[model samples]
Target: MEQPVHHFSELFEQLGLPSDAASIERFISRNSPLPPNMSLSEAPCWNEGQAELLREAVQEDADWAEVVDHLDASMHKQQ
Candidate 1:
């Protein structure tokens, strides 16, 4: 069976965040360059539930992992 594919907006929606393209861009811009030593799930921007969901997605390598990783990469990018 194939795992479901996920998108950045879907990941954001899953985390109860604004999922529009512009909102996602603004969010990434505001929070980009996450500390090199920090994990996305540990970012202060996330609520406990959101953080847990991120952690689980990564730890389990779930269907959400691709988009989660994308978000992490986007945040770590230099402006």
Candidate 2:
């Protein structure tokens, strides 16, 4: 079965950002290139904190893993 697609707003909060919709949109738009063609773990746009959080989420298959994985795949798709 396919997993449900949650809003990126939750992810913004998880990454220690404001969880507002407009802010989320702005962040994604501003973080262009998103380190195109690179792995999410190695994406240059992520700050040290953001990268570490993502790494933990993905590596541990945490509750946020699905969202983080979705983001990783989406980032590549947009490239």
Highest-lDDT candidate: 1
Misplaced by over 4 Å in model 1 are none
Worst 10 residues of 1 by lDDT: 28-37
Per residue, candidate 2 scores C-alpha lDDT tens digits across 1-79 of 6655556778878788888977766666666446565768787777899999989988987778888887776666563
lDDT tens string, model 1, 1-79? 9999988899989989999999999998998789888999999889999999999999999999999999998888888
TM-score of each: 0.96, 0.71
Q: List per-prediction Cα lDDT, in the order shown.
A: 0.92, 0.75
Clashing residue pairs for model 2:
none
- Cα displacement (Å) at residue 42, model 1: 0.6
How high is the lDDT of residue 69 in model 2? 81
lDDT assessment of candidate 2: 0.75
Give stretches of model 2 more than 4 Å off: 1-7
